[model samples]
Target: MHILHLPPEVISITCQGLEYRDLVRLRATCRALTGPATDAIRVKAWTVPMYSDCVMYKVRAIGEEEPIFQGYSFKKHFQHHFPQWLEGNLVEVQLLMSLAQEDKEDGLLALKQLTSKLENTHVHVKVVGDYSVDKNEFKQLVEIVATSPPNMTFGIKIYMNGAIGDFFIPDKVTRLCICYCRSIGDFPQFSPTSRCQVHLEIRGGDTDQVLDLFHNACQNSRNLSLAKVTVTVIPLTDPLMSRLETLEFDSVMLVGCLRSTPIPPTKGITCKSMKKLVASNFEEFSYFTSPSLRRVSFVFTDRWSREGNFIGLQRLKKALERCPSLTKVKIQAREHHLGSAETGDYWSDFFNCFEHLEDLEVVIIYSESPITGDCLDTDIIFLGKALPRLHTFCAIDDFGNSYVL
Candidate 1:
């Protein structure tokens, strides 16, 4: 039967089952499928990377809906000066470093234009860049954004290796994610207590630097409840600990050996409130010891050992032992390894580690080889033996097609 003839509710359900490309095609079939299909598209769009870019180019190109202007991207060919387009109409702007170096005049003009259009809008500005911006330019950009909206929230991510001077920001910002940036020089400089929530992600830095930044954030955010603090740090330490609701660590970098000792607790810090953790790495496997963590995601990279094989799995097993409350676990690993004999054993062992996991997603890079009998049988066996609590088992192969349960 044709999809258009189905009841709206049924069509919605069916649309949700289809791949994103298929849904887009269905939306073009006729008006009967348009409404439900569009809703599905929007929901799916948000989950997809660069959703704003897609909406801006596709939906806007056809004069459907004006896409939300969440941030700006400068056209590279145009002297790298100003943004070629503004994305997402949301009051918040997240400007990545890759798109920040357009000509200063063009960027400033575009910012002015954007502010004019979004004035009186309670906006949040997140500038992600290395500290390559000139002092006056950076100050000017901050001042302009702050002046535009009193209720605005602003944040800056300076690369960990770069130097930055003290700057004032509006008190509207309650959430922040700082990647690879260290040195919180003064603890009281930034008052985070007035805000409702705060998040910090530290990457690619020394353990001392990471601890200093975390401690500074905690000390300044006193008025905020401990539950509002969330931190992600590599080489986890006790001094950097806080009574956070969400605590994450890059395990591959932190856990050097399976026998590595856990960081001891600090005198005033408590991590009992943590609810989520992420362990990612390219080398050795990592683990977490959060008793209250509800979700854990592992991101594996293409790294080879002296024997030309992937890193340790026992470390990962050890990590899983610490997260008893884990309901969801996602493993993003290389596809070739997943289909290999070694990988089959690793997958089996990994599954055995999760006793309470309800949602399991395994994303493997694509490969051209057909699913051999050995690989297929191994996967079937693993799936069959998975935890009884497992409700959603999804495997996305290299080609992006999903095997869902």
Candidate 2:
């Protein structure tokens, strides 16, 4: 009888199907349903599910039960030199991920049947980003490859832990594609191949002679993401860009494009102290020019991947007209479905390229997922009325909830 005598559109369509610790215990038993249950929990509904300490690179797959991908890796080469590069009586594993251009050749034929018959295991394969690693040293090299023996192939070691936070990242980073590999760890020490490679003992130290005695990657990096690697002397070429003359990055997150090695591109670079830039390929928005950039994050991948957000939006509106100090923005996607109508003019030129960011206040979005689907409330209320120093806008994810666009 008295559901506040109903109608605030039936209490936001019955508290929009409750769940956020039961709508905060029904807005603590009504104080006028706590402003419609905090606007129905910012219109996101609910789903936190774990993982988000502002996420500083993460990944998983060891007795997988769910959680598997948020991206950002190496917590000190997997908590300290990845257990000293896979210790003894050996069988090691390292297989990192980011391969979803239709699971690139069936994930390298399921990792060459998990490394074509192991015989005294020692695996090393790094196809940068997504699902590839092993350690106990990585969970005891996947429990000695489930009790080894059979055509032989068990030991997949890959650790992209290029010291960050004490800074020592000179990981010569070799972008690999494991075509039934042998040796490939993109130097620091580990290169041997007449046919198939395996060797690791960066242990007497020589990762660029300890990153050349810490120049702190060009004096205490504020933020930097340099990909476009190379350093092959024994089979492996093209991928070298250590262009550091000046960089005082504040934030730069370009993540996406790797359905099996496909990122090589560079011939543009300029930064007078980047504030924030997260671009997922548009050929790196003409490769970056931050006029003291403020904040930007656009990463969309899934719907089976086509190299994240390949819609360019007129090359991100000429790279947001060369950052007029972007106020703040973040967009994350996981199931990436631009809600029908053949992507609706790429979200109508992605909301008319932020109406000239004017001095944009804030706008954070994470569609397709935060942990799985649907969060595009009419293109976020049509990008909060097509920006103009947007006061604030929201819609977080990982399914805890977020709304207010």
Candidate 3:
């Protein structure tokens, strides 16, 4: 009789002898065989047996849809970044090989020692790499992470060239960053089971691809960061944006702006729960209003406009007007020279909007003809009265001159 004709239990036991790749091939042969092959692969699977750019393995029992975490190399060089971790033999050989491929012995010894250390200590772990691991070592490392004690944090960053298959995303890992990897195939999405904070970063996918993974984070994620990702549009009203305490956008272009203009707390989907927001540049600001927002920062480049004639500044001002709960705000404007017309009580009025403001910092690239100190001094007087709750306020120009009130 063929394998498919065997009893399910017998088929599962037989398939268990096959390696992960072979089982995947076997599972593809027939629809009926997928059940047994999947069980065999799940119950006893391991990472690829060779050292490669990326590795994949299963993290849960057979038949259950557990996430596959794909470990890859990060493009950036971070060899000397973790001197302390390096000194203690906490670095894996595969990760080190990612940095220095010539040192094969060092990589092997490092992997062995790092796996030993993690298995014994179960401490907070961070794995950074550009290299791949052989099957045995990868299996041991996964085991350490799987059995890690509660309260331990785990972070892994993988940078690789092409698509990663069967990526194994472990549960409860605090931070999982995949940089420059191609695609995340079907697996348990990066949704952690516990209340543990999860941070995910995906890079180099189709610009128009909607990140359905974020939807899984609606109720659990504490923060979300997007960099250089081109998505058609992620609605501000998305549940993923609703529950987040902090949202950061870096080099991300949204097809639609969040709440084109501020909407009343009643008519719109207010991110009233978000506490902090950050934008890499003016364009990244989605203008999502949160009645409970306490902190915001925007770094404006010279592209916005020249010197004192800044439309970005005006837009930022308007955005700030809507956040009544803002307590701390920081704005960095490059190549910004405040013309006489842009000066005066205008700033005082701008500062007046944040009634609960506590800390304000403004850094501008002053032009040769910068605003006069006298004018800034006068604005300070008005600001002091309008913002009674202000404690620390400082404005620094590109020339290193500062006025603090």
Candidate number of the best lDDT: 3
TM of each candidate vs. truth = 0.53, 0.24, 0.47
lDDT string, candidate 3, 216-327, tens digits: 4444444433322332333444443343324443222234333332432223334545666565545545345666666666655534434445554566666676776676
Model 1, span 6-82: residue lDDT tens? 78789777777876545644554444555544553431011101322211112221222223222334443211221
Deviation in Å, model 2, residue 96 alpha carbon? 18
Top candidate when judged by TM-score against the true structure: 1
Consecutive 10-residue window with the lowest summed lDDT within model 1: 43-52
Candidate 1 differs from the real structure by a C-alpha RMSD in angstroms, to one decimal, of 9.2
Instruction: Quote the positional error of residue 403 for candidate 3 in Å.
Output: 2.3
Supply the global lDDT for candidate 3: 0.45
Error of 3 at 357 (Å): 4.4
- Cα deviation at 110, candidate 3, in Å, is 12
Per-residue lDDT of 88-135 in model 2, one digit per residue for the tens?
212344443224454445544444544453334444334433223321
CA lDDT of each candidate?
0.42, 0.42, 0.45
Q: How far out, in Å, is residue 36 in model 3?
A: 61
